[model samples]
Target chain A: MDRVSLIDRVSQGMKNLLVLMLVLLTGCAQQQLRGTGDLGVVIERAAGRIVVVDSSAHATLGTVEGLGDLSHASVVFSRDGRYAYVFGRDGGITKVDLLTQNIARRVVQAGNSIGGAISQDGRLVVAQNYEPGGIKVFDAETLELLADIPSTFGNNGQRSKVVGLADLPGNRFAYALFEAGEIWVADLSDPKHPQLTKYCDIGRQPYDGLVTPDGRYYLAGLFGEDGIALVDLWKPEQGARKILAHYGRGEEKLPVFKMPHLRGWAVAGGRAYLPAVGRHEVLVVDTSTWQEVGRISVKGQPVFVMARPDARQVWVNFAFPDNGWVQVIDTLDNRLIDTLAPGKAVLHLEFTPKGEQVWISARDDNRVMIYDTLTRKPVGELPAQSPSGIFFTSRAGRIGF
Target chain B: MKSLCLLMCFSLAMQASAQSTAEPTPARQHELIRLVRQDCGSCHGMTLKGGLGLPLLPDSLRDKPASSLAATVVHGRPGTAMPPWKTILAEGEAEWIVSRLLTGFPKE
Candidate 1:
């Protein structure tokens, strides 16, 4: 062996060390996301925190704190499924890392905000606000203000309460102006400067709206009347059209204790199961015809009419007095088949990805209950401080989630 | 000193008025407290700071008359999200709520 042989051997050793370093770096990057969509988060309202749960094992992972005013909290998952963006009732938007069970970034974007949506491209986050009435868009990465679209109504520069905010395909957002009786769409492809389009006469007092699974249509619920406004995203020129024209015609409206959250309503089996406000019934609408096909009589005023992931059954919960009861409607027959007494003040329910089980939050009971959808039996329970909403990360890939 | 005297007198007057009004049963008072803290707190921040609805903090209600506040709670404002509690709360109970709210809501 000579000097030349010694130098060649040293170069080979250095190359092997560099290759080993690359392999270790790749392993560290992969370990960052230790969890998957099988995990879920339950909103503990009074505690102002969220309890992360393992949906598969029906076990608690950990709890994240410092979330303010979660009484009407809602959450949306990041594209990678490793983070959840929680929208608090007090206009606080928090970016939580689900893998680590911690808050990554958080911001108070408004004085009062109901809920928000993440852009389809996963680059922008927009919150629909009540105070000063507008939608605030933020950078998904840093929670920085990206754009502001005020919901200006009338001629006096008056802003109206914006509701029914849902993200549409093509990087756009659609929501209703409760005071203006109008629906607006903002194209946020540019994020910084959004192009606006408005439909002035879409009936009265649109409370909430949701986009279809394919992101083709947006349905806005009305409070001032008995109808819903539909907007076709494929053809925005047609504007919003009213459905259920005579839904409650000639019938006197009962006093509504709490306005039903339309976000919980579902479109399944080519039909829509929406709670009829002020009525103890769930109106079944044909998705294609947009006509009321049937109605399922419930125990009380249904607040959340959610369908199973397979669209086979629809579970309904009510407001106040009737809240303690949970009603299930078989989609095949469109009738109430089973009524289960979960606990006191059953506020929300969430089905697993393939609809195997559902996690329920009983605020009065101060616990989260998981039940097998097939057997309708209790599986597990996690103690919480006044839980109101339960969200699973499997929603990351679903449209109009 | 004069302003301080007036403030003390006003506080006593309000307290006397609250006592004179219909005093809820211990159970009913407990129920009302839970309802306001949880149900009403859903929209109006749990801490009563502010949320979808405006704050019900004593500082904000201090300027307003207690009678009007009680009336608003019972009858609710028209054309707003606030629903009338007439079905659930009696007029006297609303007055009691107003009295306690003007000072400070009971945590328990």
Candidate 2:
């Protein structure tokens, strides 16, 4: 064995080892390369877990568990769509990583929480709580507490439950105080010191609220009365005004089995489709004038009146008993075009990014039903355990979700 | 002997009136469990710790009279959002639910 030949063989072995390491690294990178744009999460209410789903594939990717008290869980996607902030009924806020299919961080922020919202800049996450009755702002990345604003009202300093939390432009959040009957805007431009704008006496019992797509208006649905309280974000000095007041026409209201959810998608084609508090009808209001333009009778008390992405159609799901049915209305004609029973106890629904398909959660049946919006036919289904609240990554880019 | 017989008959009547004609079948009991866990769980927390409505935990309900609780379930509190369940629940089912809620609701 000559010295030059021995040295050549040793260098060749070193080269081979480097090649092997390169192959292993590329394999690991390939596993994490997929984009999260088509990802979403479905809450398995009874199990206290979330099933991460891929909308493009029409399949569930993975399940993340150990989220406490998810019975009324709502999820919000981070700006990059890589993380989903789940707000649980037990006041737990869990940040789940979509790529890793695991909980990145979990914190029980309060005794009980309703839902949450992410700031416009995506730097902060806010949880609306029922126990301490306030909004707690957290650092989105580390889940560290940043600010706590109690919904305190009255001379006795009673804290009101915060509802209808939605992020607005300029790093602000607008929410309603259920007991105080007020709408407040929290400006977090200075994350350390939050500036508050309070609008008092908005209406009686603002159950939930929604911000328009343009980020110009915030509307709160009054459960104690027959009207909606509207605040134009562009002109806060004008204060909140009641719209569609006395919509019941002095008639007694039917028993509302479940509270209706208000969201920005309720607006379609310059018309907002709102569920009448206790009536089996959906009130159509002209967005410009905020007047009750028409009423479309429905099967049962509507729980969620949402619009498709293109603003061409509106979909409605009813409360129990009638909850097994879903109704669709064509925006152009503003008439009931189709009525379909997707499954038993349809708890929630979410549309795809382009609005071609919609996913409906049938909690009692333990399955998520997918349907073709254009044909109004069942296209696919995914089995879930007592599913509720289907959320998609597309919400990350929207002003209010 | 006559007075003793009368007392026994009155007790029998009370027991018969306190319960439905017959105990709910096992299948009906399962349905009732789901209704209370999911539907009623909406306002009261699923764990029954409470949300928009008052908590229905055993401790919270133990002090209240079972009869009054059952009546509230059947008729509902008028001013509040609790809607009467007379249309959905059968006779004496409310009483059954009150008894169950007072003893810690079943998980299933």
Candidate 3:
């Protein structure tokens, strides 16, 4: 070959090799996703970082840092559970690659945000904002802003604070307005052109809410009212109805030291176990009938009431002063079976997919505690900094995690 | 005699306020600063502008009496999400927070 022809040929050969390498890398990435769903991320709140934990292996991987304002941070995993979309209080949405323990794409989506949800189809991600209150949707993969729906209720030109945003079937998002006392369903089937169905007068001051695991109901716990506001997403025309009206009604209640998070409602044995605000108890609701079935008295004001994967038992945490304890309730007999003091301040709980074990984050102790749910004994621990929320990727497939 | 008793009661109340708002030590002050900026910042905004809770900016709190603000921190606002911090914070610490909040919270 002539010298010039040889040079051109070599360059072309290199280009072809690059193309093949890229194709191979993409294939490997697809293969790696199969095991990624077993991964989990722990929120190092005081510090802007997350410690990736391998749930199946029960080991700490690495820490991804520099995501801002995680004081009240929460995370939702991607459909494949490879990427963790971290929602920061400073209105930042960060997409982190669990395998690499690095931030893949990060964006300050809003001014201030509490939490967010991923659509069932995994095509869209929506964040519920507190400032200039509204919901903003973005492309799941690219984090591109697709739609913006402000929480302007009734004739008011101003937006109201939004809360309790959760993902639903049919590419829809459900959230409550704290000031407007309303619930809005954002239909994102189109992704670009979104439609909203409003359920007005949904009790009052919905501090937080969540969708049932079966994706049939959306319940918001009211701060302004005594009971929970429920919506039958299957029947959007009926709007919302108040259930457990007299749950805490007319009773002399303790001063709520902290707002009980309603998102942690645990569904086990065909019943919903929710922490009652200002009450040292968990309200058991029959999901089929939507009736108040019973109440299980816990150690203190309940914070997180979570069910083991097998739905045989439920775990409960508490607000400050009583925040250092974790209580487990038996689903079969519906009684408090055990109580474990994980550490100084037991903040969050997460169970491995098959319910073989569970992880708990204790903020004061600055460590993650693992317990064998079945054995009811201490298993392991991973050191972290001011950890508050622990999220397992198994949650990606579950509704309203 | 009655007038003197009332004056003495007023002086004692003033002393309590003064004692509670007594400037914290530099180390304790740093912890207090974080408490307002992180724990309280969870809802009030890291910069204290506002989020789920209303703004705690100097401008927003300038009009609010420091005593009332201190009381809110100590006793908490009933019928609202603001919980009583008496469990974690002392009366004086709350007073200190009120004073700092009124005069622009420290960034650090």
Candidate 4:
């Protein structure tokens, strides 16, 4: 070949190489996130929008808007994964249709309903009215207030700090009081008039609690004790049993850590993982034995804990300074696999019922992050306003009020 | 008697030299200016206008006593994020910094 022809060929090859490099760089830059189920993971962006991405990690799905800012909202998917119910800390409860990606209806509830959890039947949505230390039952269909259970148990004046809520079979709900150090079991059998059956004291100011799959026992995190107390529901009179103490690995033999500040926990595969904020470590407790099996240290003040049951992987949210990243841990190996930087104050992560994907709330950035569960890659970003809490839908298309 | 008198004279001269060295000089003033621009300016703004901390300029701390300001710098106010600097800074250095903060300039 002539020299000029050879030079032209080389130039073309270089252009192709450059293109390939660009493609490779873009592919490398994209993060791997898991989806909760067959439906793409839906993330509530703090920017008052929602983004949905499918499981294959291909195709950017859609963007929806109209969630308020600074609300620290929590989104729960309906049973069929059709609609997302958003409850904000600043009194904004919105129903977003996942199919259309639109805010169907918005209503202002009482002050600072930061989080809400729907029952298995999806008829009642129980919201924690933060300031008053109580749970407000709203008609899941009408979004109307049905009942309010106040912190009327003890002499403690302020409303008990109600941080989390979980649904049990039937119309029963277990709510955690962050300040009052008690867990109240309520029967919403009659949605209009919910009754608090009994109170089990956990420890000094219990922050949150997690129940096992069998629903026989509840583990509560003591913000003060540097440990968690186990509650046996079958025997409520036994009170909360202080099971595992101090991250399972402290030289002092006593609780040297001043404030354990347990913020988030995940229970699966007969093991419970609680992120102790003051200790800056994740404590893994075996549910069957009721003992702390292991501990993993991470960055400052981890607040939200999540795990994929099939994958044996756990993710934790560090509330400040790199707020949107999660520390991934391999439970089988009991080692930190990687630090997932999702960007912008990721305060919550929830898996779909099928556990195919995970939805994340980018609280400060106002968006939700959808990740593919298997690859753990970012598939999409959803717009939301200060979205913090997340739950799955009751049904594919059911947009709860 | 002669040796004692010579020792006393030498001690007096040494004390005078020490006082002279301790006295704030123009070089020390320049150093304080550098510190104000580098250390104090970072948190309190380029003009010593406070952001998270109290303002260091004369207009912001107009009637505030130098002693109180010095005390604050040496022993940070408790129940807040401010940390005590007694461990970090020496007594004289703290006093100098506080004096500069209060007067809006170094002791010149």
Who wins the TM-score comparison? 2
Q: Please report, as a residue range, the 10-residue window in candidate 3 chain A with the lowest summed lDDT.
A: A29-38
lDDT string for model 1 (B82-108, tens) is 777887787778888888888888885
Give a tens-digit lDDT track for model 2, residues A1-401: 99999999999999999999999999898586789989999999999999999998988889999999998889998999999999999999999999888899999999988999999999999999988999999999999999999999999989998999999999999999988999999999987799999999998889899999999999999988889999999988898999998899779888877888896458888899999998999999999999989999999999999999998999999998789999999989899999999989998899999899999999989999999999999999999999999999999999987
lDDT of 4: 0.62
Instruction: Flag the better candidate by lDDT, 1 or 2.
Output: 2
Q: Show model 1 residue runs off by greater than 4 Å.
A: A1-33, B1-20, B49-54, B59-65
lDDT of 4 by residue, A116-173 (tens): 7777677877787665568888877778888888865566566665755666666677
Q: What is the TM-score of chain B in candidate 3?
A: 0.79
Models, CA RMSD each:
8.5, 6.0, 6.8, 15.5
User: What is the DockQ score of candidate 3, to 2 decimals?
Assistant: 0.39
- Candidate 1 chain A, run of 10 with poorest lDDT: A28-37
Per-residue lDDT of A1-401 in model 3, one digit per residue for the tens?
79999999999999999999999999798656447867889998878898898887778888999989887788888988889999998899999998878889999978888889999988888898987689999999999999999999778587988899999888988899998999888889998888888989888789899899878899999887689999998887888999888888678777675567877558888899988877898999999998988999988999888888889999999876688899999998789999999998787888888888989998878899999998889988888988989998888887786
lDDT measured at residue A194 in model 1 versus the true structure, 0 to 100? 96
Off by over 4 Å in 3: A1-34, B1-38, B45-47, B86-90, B104-108
In TM-score terms, candidate 2 sits at 0.92
Interface RMSD of each: 2.3, 1.0, 2.3, 12.2
TM-score, per-candidate, Cα-based: 0.87, 0.92, 0.87, 0.62
Show the lowest summed lDDT stretch of 10 residues, model 4 chain B: B38-47
